[model samples]
Target: MRKNKLQRQASTIDKKFLLLSLFLTVVGLVALADASAPLAQRNFGDKFFFLKQQIVWAGVGIVLLFIASKIHYRLWEKIATIIFFLSLFGMLMVFIPGIGTKLLGARRWLVLGPITIQPSEFLKLTLAIYLAKVSSKNKKLAAYFVPLILALSLIMLQPDLGTAIVVSTIGMAQLFVSGISLIYFASTLALGGVLGFILIITSEYRRDRLLTFFEQTRDPLDKSYHIRQILLALGSGGLFGVGLGQSRQKYLFLPETATDSIFAIIAEEIGFLGASILIIIIVIFVIRGFAIARASPDTFSRVLSCGIMSWIGAQTLLNIGSMVAIVPLTGIPLPFFSYGGSSLIALLIGCGILLNISKYGKE
Candidate 1:
């Protein structure tokens, strides 16, 4: 007899993964409805244009989650290497002219006819699966990590420092959970940090970002403009906010209001309490994710759960930190709340994988 495999599946199918996604998706839609109103009204002549797009994408993501949730998480282990390589190829494809699209000087998107996809977004999940598979094969390799660092360099070549950092951090966290040699981990960490710093400081734009972080007021009209305005939005919110749909900042006063700075609009609308609650929900998600991972039966599922959780949690923290002047800016969005169809889809799929893992996780 399979002993209680069937019972476990029956019991765990709709556990924390479903619950967290439900909370996040609902909250994300609500926030997007609020944040996208001003930007949509100004750009699209409709208050709900962006929100509608998000709702459609969320629907598609839900379909994906529903489909993926029924599949076995172990299948990811089987295809992880192939997916990783294919995604790496996709990342490299951005260098090919005519095929790649550049919006603000940096090329990071692939345009195929009428459709475009950001490879870095897919690369995050690919790397997560690859790390989980590799760690399962040999835990020692987790410590002497370079594959992710190399991929980060490739992504940074696209000049997308934000995605690279998120991908790299998730990879590191996966390795950390694998319990590889600490000395090797430290060596990889120091080397990777030096390389990352070198890469950042060497670039004129990135260096300007760093310098702005140190003295934002020095270049108020230049590099620091984004930071200054973001801080102004945060400060203007004070304790209670400026009231719903009344943000003066979104009226062409803030850059990337629909993307990197979406959280600012939230702060400007509902104040500090709202932001704190959002953070609390994210923390709850992380806690539940790790608990499921820890409760998993197999090494692959364990690492996979950790990888997915870290991917969302670390990115969320970095996004919020950069928003409020706690860290250097990375133009990453706040997961589902940001106006990106691809990001939302990828995240929901990742969440689905977590659910699959939880269902079959070891006791």
Candidate 2:
């Protein structure tokens, strides 16, 4: 009977969810190897440096996923506050002298010797978990909303509007699914939109991005260069593409080829068909994730699953929208696909939590 129970529990795990995540991970690794080759070689004198590091991180993420999947989902609720504070501490460390690392005029990373991390990445995950726990208890809006605002203020100070937006969206989405009043929901969303607009227009670089999105001809080789190159890469892909690993743009012409603009490179190499396949996979992941959320056995698990789903789905939309010129480029990393260790790890861990919840979901 004990052996049979073990087998039954194993069967309750979401195999389709795990398979889709693995599929995306494999695709990301292959695409990063191709997209980062030229950039990595030029900067580090090694074509495979980034790819090798990414593989190591992916291995670590997989191990973490497995461990997290086996743990009880309820355990997170007990420590959600602790995790949030710890995440905040890490984010604060990024502002300290001699520890905070600045790149491209933004202070967003904490560099501790050979290990550098973006605390904001982990903060997003912890924030979602914290909010879900708070909202699950039917707490006052201030319980979740005020703290989220505080977090957003710090994130924006990092001058990372992309991450700030994504984090805020994830938190708000959790509140929405937690049975918040309709009036409160509409007001909060409107407020968020206005605040986002103000944040964008006040910052020179962000304002320029917005302006460039409207008028690409204003600064073709400067402010607008990234978007134009992205469009060119997509257009060049045509129907089938230039073929995998044959992209010319990765050779220093397109900016952020291996990071923010990797999707464009994918399109340029594998064509429209390949890009559509990726988009479809993401769509399916979102649908099935929500299905799990709906089937959750309790409020905390339901809210947590919904929050995680929003983080992945919203970020994916933002990244893809920027590349396609629908939204102004926000420098957001595509989940599972972007070449960032912290992002991939946080995402996989979230998936593991969702999987664990699936086991106890209402059948």
Candidate 3:
């Protein structure tokens, strides 16, 4: 019986999901090394500075992934509340003097001794787990929406609108998977839309981004330079590409080459063919994730799985959409591919949980 049980467990693991994630990680590391070389040398005096940091984070993320996968996922249900509050506390720390680090006008990182963290990333993951655990029990908007609003408010106050949007998307996806009524979902979406519009208009910089996205003004160099540069990078690669490690734009022609605009650099270097392959890989990841969610043996696992998939899907849409000029620039990072220790680590751990859930899925 024990041997059969072990065999059952082994057979149930989602190899497809695991393989796709590994593929993306390998692709991300390769692309990042190529994309960050020039900037790393200019800023840090080393061609591989950013690449080395990312490799270190990747190692740390792999270790966390193993631990999160080994821990029975149900324990997340027991400690979800504590995790959520701790995430919120971390968010608050971003405002503390000397501890909070500001970059590019946003105070989104907290320096805790030797380490720095972006709490919004942790908030996105923890909130998904907490909502999955609670919404599975309560099944009401009042039960989950209030805390979501509180979390969003805190995140937005950090002026990290991109992370706020991602967290909200995860919460709404969880609500839908929990069987919330259509009217309720519709109402929630509409309310969110109105609130988003208000937030965008109230901030001068956000308003400028919105305007730049919709209609280019007299000065392209001021507000819309980034978008125009992104278009130039993408368009320069007509069919195949300029060739890997040969991106012209990476030589100070474009900004954020290693972060938000990394996809554009990918396109510039590898052309449409390579970009399409990356997109196809992401599509496979999302489909497998939802399939695992559908096969989950319990409500909590199913809902959590849905939330995690939505988190990745929504971020992908935002990041790619902005790159192709279909949406405004939001400074959102492309999953696994973007250069950020916090994002990659949080995402890998989330994948670990999803993998653990897959083992218990209905075969």
Best by lDDT: 2
lDDT of each: 0.83, 0.90, 0.89
Model 1 lDDT tens row, 1-363: 476776756456646658778778888888778777777998899989888888888999998987778788888889988988898998899889999888887898899896688888888998898888888886566332667766787887888988877887888788888876799778878887898899888898888888888887977876899999999999998888899878888877888888889899889887888778878888888888888889877778888888888989888998899999989888898887888888999899988888777776655
Please, what is the TM-score per model? Answer: 0.94, 0.97, 0.97
* Candidate 2 Cα outliers beyond 4 Å, as residue runs: 1-11
Model 1 weakest lDDT span, ten residues long = 138-147
Q: Model 1: how far is 311 from its true place, Å?
A: 1.1
Which residue pairs show collisions in model 1? 296-362, 297-361, 297-362
Report the lDDT tens digits of candidate 2 across residue range 1-363.
Answer: 967765676558888998998888988999999999999999999999889988988999988998899999999999999999999888888889999988998899998898789889988889988998898775788898877988898898888999988998898889898998889999999999999999988888989989999997777899999999999999999989999889999999999988999999999998999899889988998898889899998889999999899999889999999999999999999888789888999999999998998887776
RMSD of each: 2.0, 1.9, 1.6
Comparing 2 with 3 on lDDT, the higher-scoring candidate is 2
Question: Which residue pairs come into collision in candidate 2?
Answer: none
Residue 208 lDDT, candidate 2, scale 0-100:
91
Could you tell me the lDDT of residue 13 within candidate 2?
82
Cα distance off (Å), candidate 3, residue 3: 11
Error of 3 at 162 (Å): 1.4
Alpha-carbon deviation at 136 in model 2, angstroms? 1.6
